[model samples]
Target: MLRRLAPVVLSLLVMVLGVTALAARPQRSAPPHTADFVVVAGVAGLRWEDVDPRTTPTLWRMAERGSIGSLSVRSAHRPTCPVDGWLTLGAGSFAAWNGNRPAGGCPQQAVTVERPDGTGAKLPDQESVVHYNQEQLPWGAVPGSLAESVRCSVAVGPGAAVAAARPFGRVDRYAPALPEDPTQLLGSCVLSIVDLGTVAGTTRAQREAAARTADAQLARVLAARPPHSLVLVAGISDTDRSARLHVAVADGPGWERGWLTSPTTGRDGYLQLVDLAPTALAALGRPMPERLFVGRPAVAVDGRPDLADAIAKPLDAEREAANQRAVAGWFYTLLAAVLMLLAVAVLPLLRRARRHAGPHGPEPVPRRVVAVVELLLIAAALAVPAALLADAVPWWRAERPGLTFAGVTALLVAAGTAAVRFAPGYGSTLGPLGAVAALTALVVGADVVTGARLQLNGVVGYSAQAGGRYAGLGTVGLGVFLAAALLSAGWLAQQVRKGWRPAVMVAVTGLAVVIVGSPYLGADPIGAIALTAGLSVAAVISAGGWLTVSRLAWAVMAALGVTIGLAVLDLRRPVGERGSLGRFLAAFGDGTGGLTLHRFSTSNFDTLVSSPLTVLALAGALLVWFALLQPWGGLMRLFGIYPAMRAAMAGTAVAAVIGGVLGGVALDVAGAAAALVVPMAALAALRVLDHSTDRTVPTSGRPRGVGSGVAGEDGSGSDGGGTGGVGPLGDGGPGGAGGATGGRDAGRVQPGTATSDGPVG
Candidate 1:
């Protein structure tokens, strides 16, 4: 009874314990002392690669002496232009222009500054931009929020005016351009923002010239800087339509040479454009407006590599992210194609195998073609993890990145599949399923537990450039991890004694949940909730393949408890220490979460249509229903004979629903299940189809013929290698078509075992 109820009771208990422990953790230290003045030097399309020692000496010097990181310039739209970045920085929130792009891609920055009072300047159209972000978009950005937060501010160029102007378009002080000798301009206010112009160009030489000019301007500003001031330099936006990582650097008290990070993006060496506003406010010792600002103060952790080596890091990351962005869509299409081709080939190939066999009516298909199909299925099942592993290689730098990436992934899949399929005891249904499931679970689990480094910009993983996530499991990772973990639980249940099945399932799934939601690990609270629900289904089904109302109520309770616990846990963390989920909840509590649902709905809908995982999901469903669930597929028979497998399938269904709705990547869950479960189901179906072809039933296909070996659902047979050729993976005794019976049996067929002429099992 305790084993049967383990998942229901233990999962809830462990989550509570984890939360309690976190609640007791020590509070973090306070922030650095405030600066007298905060100077923001904004540049559009600045990249770390553009900072050359000789040409851009000032910028390079700043990179070496100050804390530097790659800036994620994501706003409400992809490829955030100069105006959008400026507006977002001023608002301290994600902002965008809803208008269509200009012919060259991004809209040109043409700010018309009016001399309102003869001493200050005003923006003519700044109010419209403010209204769009606050009223029309989900971000609720109010242009000039940074300037509004301070008593007075200064602006040097057109872009800077967008950032420093008041809601009604007034700037305390504004200049058309920087003067050669203007210490008074910067010292006019505690907050000053100056635009260094655009550094991105279509040609290398053009970019170099732009960098030189920006560096010269920066040098002049630094020379005239007031004492006890904090300086911030950033590539604030994309120059064109395509998004990429930009440069970020901070130099001030307690911000000496180190890596830059923010609570918004927990990972080191990464900060968002929104963070710039919060950083400016923190530098000037202003109180952050929780309702308006969605960013946290930036922190610079000590330590960095040599200047040259540190510079190459962001450059390399950008290359990989760009490569993945280009090819990720096609990779999903290829996976869908693989599933479709297998669906098309299965029936025809099986029919051909039947025809090749002698007219011994109802005999098993005897062609090696089945082995080829099974092998291909095995490779497809492990494709996600294989693709993630492939990221370790510089396939993106190859002359043909897409093709090179595909080939490398294929090689990895072949290698992993071969190792699993050819390992000892492969003949047993448990061996192949267990090995494949465990491998997938282990790879994804280890990645999430560690830093998920391989998942960054991976073909099947998320990129920092997207700005939706940073240090934890992305939707794709969630899908893969949940599917593999559930299946792995099922496999472990099979190895234990029947009475201990549900107990083991609970243990495995509980550990997986901890890793997925621990804040220090996967940092996916929703994933933890979803997986707990799914595994409870597996646990109940394994105990007895029934989902009564009582069991469902318990499962729902466990999931809900986890959800509330995660939310509470996040709320308790300090403002600058909370994850994305906590920040959302905080924003929601402050009334800004009103449009969050609208935003999520729009994004989820867009992903549903644009992602190729949708095609893969549709194809997988067609194949599963038309081929596996149908009577002829033999999978239905296997489920009845193998309760552990039934438990795995049922649990996966529950997970898909919950994870998809909450994680906003529904098709990813389906695709992951299709990749891992479909192939294993196909293998099980093959065993059932070839059940009678082994030595036990023989070519005579008669019920009373000489009994050879009948491979039970567990693949244990009587004696002798069965005549069924399931490749080198199995022998008819104890493990499948060539399955072997219990060791207790010598050469005799076990009692109560079914024959070709009798009912199955």
Candidate 2:
């Protein structure tokens, strides 16, 4: 044993020594002045005019030593300041391809087309398609190819310094294709990868953290400096004030038209963002890629050039008209319709309070306030449907009228009536029923108009028309449906408060709608469509649970109807499709294929069974479910279960079962797991639940610690002359009861009792 221990100790010592020696070894140093080339780039939301020369002396110094010019950005689709900044520094072709073409010709990107005779599809392929922004960073692709093109030891990416962590290397090129829904995308959409402004400007605390992260990245780049390094420094010099300047530096100095500068008065604008990329590439001694460069870099122009001289000149009559027609005609109409519905529904709630109250009457009950609040909540009801509609529209057209008006009016009316009548109260089964009817009508309408296809593609737009973006109207419709469902649920909850039967009726009504509407809205058969519908249903249900029953019901009903309406819209097709139900259903699923009865057993089953990560996620979810179980919980009590522990366990089991169903598991396995796992997990998780339950005694239990003046535990008499009770410290004294204890001694007495100074004492 001693011999063996000795050898082991010796080995450990050697290992430690080896590690120490390795750590002490000097690191290899970068070669000095043996650079092939250096490249620099800039980022968006910045302009040259706004940059204070004194604030950025290093940039000025570099400019004096090297060439500075305004960079022209070339983009395939709509003009994107961020993408242009990132790609200009990515690789170079020529000035002509820099995304700015005076003639606004065909996009630099390759196009594919099929022959009229259907022999084969023709592919106008280019040498290599370089996606400067979207691909390199976020997608984690090796940027070595980009580096090799410039023959540089290092390549710095383009991004706003204040806004970027590294550089603006990755941007959402598809943004132009996104829908133009002010309420949905512009107002509420949080596409993090695409919206760098939000990411950078999240909060003061977050910005500080981001700044630190950026500093660390800069340090890393400096440490890894190779001979032929490409340093692309892009970002706003400072965005704290009104004036903001964008600067991009490629290489160190002395590159032709390499440096670009942009200035903007506002924090975020387009022009400044467009100047950073090509300038940086020029610094690297590589000509701007023909596919990207359109004209001169920003700094190249001593003053702002005429609009005509800019690389991205306006399109001529026919092209511009065609582009305008796609959105201005149908998209604007949809936006108007959705906006109108919102205006009509929300404006009435403010008036409800005045109508319900009398000048001198007692204050309204919590229920009445809830009713008033619900009326005001029309905006919330409209929001989800608008989002759904936006998702339904394709990126190309993005906006269409068909999706906006679909079921919106009926949903609004149903929600309004339910809200008003139930003021300080809640909706009844009738409201939800009405909502379901409205959604059904809309769905039926879509189906009929689509030629009886039953394929539910862009029907309402929000229903998942796969591979499409910017379907705004569908989003609005979905919001309506959810609002309706939530309203129904709230109404039932209120009924339950008054009497269990009414609540039960309301719940049943909502469940019925879910069962029926789910199919029509493509929430059942088509996977993607079903997913959205189910989520909408769940969201409304949760919302109803949060507020008072009456309030909940009205809100839910409005939300539900809106959600369904939004879910059925299709943006790719025109408004004419709105009047056709046959085409609508055909889009949901292949009509010729009928309903895919075997999908559950085949595709869905196979996918679920094969993924281990999915299985682990399911397990984690089960743990959370068990952790929330409570037998005597309010939910269980509402259903008549008095035992809290039992109720909690049952809830857990139900939750687990639901989770399993959502995870698309086999019924047998889900059932078995629900039975075995839920009970055991619930038992283990009971500790947390037990702690959360209130431990306070009932109001009638005892007179809360007797005041100083009161004697007996009942706290009835004055301390001065009444029978005094034992003091808190248990000193049996008359003064201790009220005077010494300071209850009645200081001339203070209980509201109904007179002090010793008064005759009553």
Candidate 3:
């Protein structure tokens, strides 16, 4: 009775626990000191080495007395741009301009503009166009702008003002005259933005002159500020080269005299641009809402002079070198895919040759040789994780990437060989495959839990230098790893003892969902959606008898339901803490959701048009199709010959492809999906090859008059030994399909026992 009730009780317990965990609010750290006002000087594309103490004494002094670091300006949708950077800093979220202009055209000079109520106001000549664009363009808002939380805010330049005015609900536009003493304005405005257009100067001499002027202006403001004022000087972007890394410095209240470190990038001298607003709010003693901001606070770290030097290099050189390496990596990946396809095409001929060679054949490759081959495959399977670990090795730091990659591959292969030789279940068909899948899941999951340190450097994982993602698994890694682990683990559970098998399957599924879906762990909205939907369909198919159109529909509906439920929970969090689902919903509410969709669509279209990634994706899809229909009759037939397991594999493949396509389209990188689907497809093909050579049955069709080795759901005659004849199930016995039991075994086959004659139709 207790056993029967266990599933129900466990299900309820898990659901309750999940809800409670999600509902808990995040805690904010107390600021080291309080500040009355915060000033942000926006210097577009300002580099540390460009500023000399003699020419820009103010900036140099601030760096020595405050905190400084490299500011990563990459955004979710595009490379860093000045307009986007200022907007993101002010809004505390990722944002972009629609590049629309007002119908009447922009103002060329200073002019008096009237509010909708007819009140006249003077606007800066350069800022008039920006003001017009702000009112005309459709904008996406996840949270109220930073200005909304402060008592009063001032924007000194057009770029700064455009972002500052976003949260204002009134129809008035005004530009207050700059005070003679810049510090005098601090008493009235709690926040201020001063844009110096530092990168606008074309020549070194011109740039130096502009820097001196900006420095003097900054000195005046600092001299006038109150005792508790906080100042943040940042280079929002390099207009000429958007991808160049820039600088950020923090001074005054609560900040220590050292370099900056952040959890987002897991680098001591690096902080993302999105972190600025949150750090300012924390310094000013404001409460931060959950999930609304993608960045964490930048903490002060003990000064590391070498770290600063490493980050202070010319942005152009660093970007050029990184781009070169990335291109080479992509080319190598494409070559590998082509080779995998070639191997698949040749597998059939090899299998046929083995079959024609009689009972002994060419005595199987020595165990040692086979083990070496298996280890190599295992290393390939773990390519992403291995690359991540390789980044920290001292030899990897020597800039000989090729040598480091080879060494890491060899090490992983050796480790895998040792495990296969000693690990339990290694002799079983699913053992080694399951072990690889499980290890991949564990490594990736553990990295995510611990701030995604290794993945931050992994070739296939998030790239900190590129700033595409700072944490969490990439779409491709998540989809591929999750699918492989689930299928392998589920199959392995079935091969073990009966009493704990069902529980094992349940546990595996549950753990997978928790790891991938939990916001604090994976923090990936799209991933959570895809995994929830795909896993649900796979689980159902694994438990049910077969896949049909109606069953498929139900499975899809169940998946959709789970996805929506998770999205709704994300929406319940504060606007600042909301994930993609919540952000999209918020944008949709204000009719700006179309822009977000357009960004995703354009990104996907660009990737497809520009790269060979699509070819890899198509190859993967074709491989899965071939495995299911022609070569293996599906992976299900090869494993335990259980119809339910076959249904599960088929369903999972469909789900993975669907998820991969959706992820590729949504994330705008087809390579991510290709990376995921290609590996699993190759594994499936390999599984088919392994089964074909080992099984005794004819390749083309079902057996003629023999019993299957597996038992029915009822488990009757499960332990029966061999019967008669030469059959695939076992050594043959008597009475054809029913074995020695005659007609009594018509609907059921004894487990691990087979008749000598062909199976009965």
Candidate 4:
């Protein structure tokens, strides 16, 4: 008994140690933050491409001397406007005015300013903007929180005043424009913000002119004498009606010569606009008020030898992220369409096969036709992972990115499907499904353990522009992996002895969940919860016996235990260090859990209605319940014969439901998984029904893939005429599905593809 459990225990122990090492990794701590004075140069719509030595010399030099990163300006709303950007920066969290503004380039920066005294100004209407962000929006942003944290502050322009004003809309010191010698104004306070104005234009010439103007003002501001100061430059928001990565530079005492990053965005050299407030407050030695800030202080990492190259990574991401937003919608719609087409085409065939079966035997399905449909089903399942892997190539930079991406993805799906169709043990019914599921799991899992580079701008992955996740496995990716891994694990459990099946299922699924829940890997606590729930259900069912209320209770209890354990582990880390699960736990503990839930619920609702993935999820669900599980569907017999496969499908479905809601992206995660697996399930049902009444199934009377019948289960070949040419690829493995003429039994059955009239355990 001890030897039997040794592998599972050892494997689990290894994974735990790996997670511990990754989580305890050194947090980015800026060196003491000794600079007492902080200067924030707010440059709206500044891209790295716009920075030139001749036209924007000061900004160019600033990048060369400091830590540089691309800024993601996601505020309380989509397309963070200039005003929204300024307020978010001020509050150190997502905030939006939600005012009526032009749909295109932002309206000219405006604020109703009243000069209270010679050196002070007040924007009366600023109070309204603050009120709207706090009272109406999900993010409870206090606009002047940055100023209120310190004793005094200075604002140079209208935009600067938006950031520098205290909560009541009052600016301690304000100036309409930069003074020639601003030493006194800058030295009078610990913090100073200068708006370099919007750098934007439809034409190249106009942009260059605007760049020169902002550059001149920036140069003058830097010329002022202020000792022991930190200078920060951020292209704070999106403009021209598009969201793109903007420049972020910090030239200060401890922040020189490195990549700028923060814990909020696990990816190096990328930080959000909200990070600016914490950066300023940290430098000035001011405490960040709890619940008022959502960003962490920026830290510098020294790795990139060339600043231009480091900055280019985010710039490329900007392009790829945009391209994905454009192409992914079309891809999901295509996926849903294909799955629907499969249903339209397969349903009739399955019913026809079933209706023709008589007591003597079942009607013979042409092997050629069966093989083709099986091949098509496999191809369909590969689409989701193929799209994600397609991002490996820089197709986004092509002249026609949308077309190029489609071509690349189609080729990948074709190649992967061909490989799976012809692989060894092709005759096994679970062989093909298991192979594809394994591929899906490997692609998503390999990407995360290796830094999630593929997921950064992956078509099926999360978007930085969306601002929900900057790094770690995305909710969609999590769903895909969850379904694939559990299915593959189910296939594996069937390969072992019946008594050992549950142990194997738990080990495989649990390790995958740990990777998913780890702060350093999947970086999604909520996903872990979903995975845990799925794993518990799968392991329980694999132990044998049909699902009962008591069994369901046991699964739920196991999931709850895992959820609490993960949250506790994550909360041990510092604020912003915890992943999704930890953050939710912390919020709930502090009485803000309701707000977080509302925020997630709202996001989920939006995705539920707007995303095409919802159609795919519903399709998968419908197929599972209405078609496969029904008496007319014919797949119900397959489940009664082989409960392990049933366990896999059940677990994936349960996990998908939990993930769809907790993941905040609604059906996208679950939909991708369903799109991948449901087609495969439909294909299996067709295969089983095709041979249900056949008289040539060995007469062994042993249902294939049940109890001890799974190993060595021979699958019938697709081609009909030959005695036994290998499964789809050619020259079958012992029982490969192939050109079928006369095999030993004349009818090769997939893993449990044959029906069993005996009672299930």
The number of the candidate with the highest lDDT is: 4
Task: Give stretches of model 2 more than 4 Å off.
Answer: 1-106, 109-466, 469-477, 497-761
The TM-score of predicted model 2 comes to 0.24
Error of 2 at 131 (Å): 9.0
Model 4 over residues 543-612: C-alpha lDDT tens digits?
4467889888988877786666555677897774566566777888898777787888888999999989
Best-to-worst order by lDDT is: 4, 1, 3, 2
* Candidate 2 lDDT trough over 10 residues, lowest sum: 462-471
In model 1, which regions exceed 4 Å deviation? 1-30, 348-363, 692-712, 715-761
Judge candidate 3 at residue 201 and give its lDDT: 55
lDDT of 3 by residue, 557-675 (tens): 75676566666777787664566667777767766667666656665676566545456555555655664334333233233333224433553455455554555443223333334
How many pairs in model 2 have backbone atoms within 3 A of each other, for residues 3 or more apart or on separate chains, i.e. clashes?
174
Instruction: Give the local distance difference test score of model 3.
Output: 0.53
**What is the C-alpha lDDT profile of model 2 across 94-156, one tens digit per residue?**
111123432422222322222333311221211222332323212111111233333212211
Task: Kindly report which residue stretches of model 4 are placed more than 4 angstroms away from their true locations once superposed.
Answer: 1-26, 102-105, 355-365, 694-761
**TM-score to true structure, per model:** 0.89, 0.24, 0.72, 0.90
Model 4 TM-score relative to the real fold: 0.90
lDDT of each: 0.75, 0.30, 0.53, 0.76
Error of 1 at 529 (Å): 1.9
lDDT of 3 at 86: 70
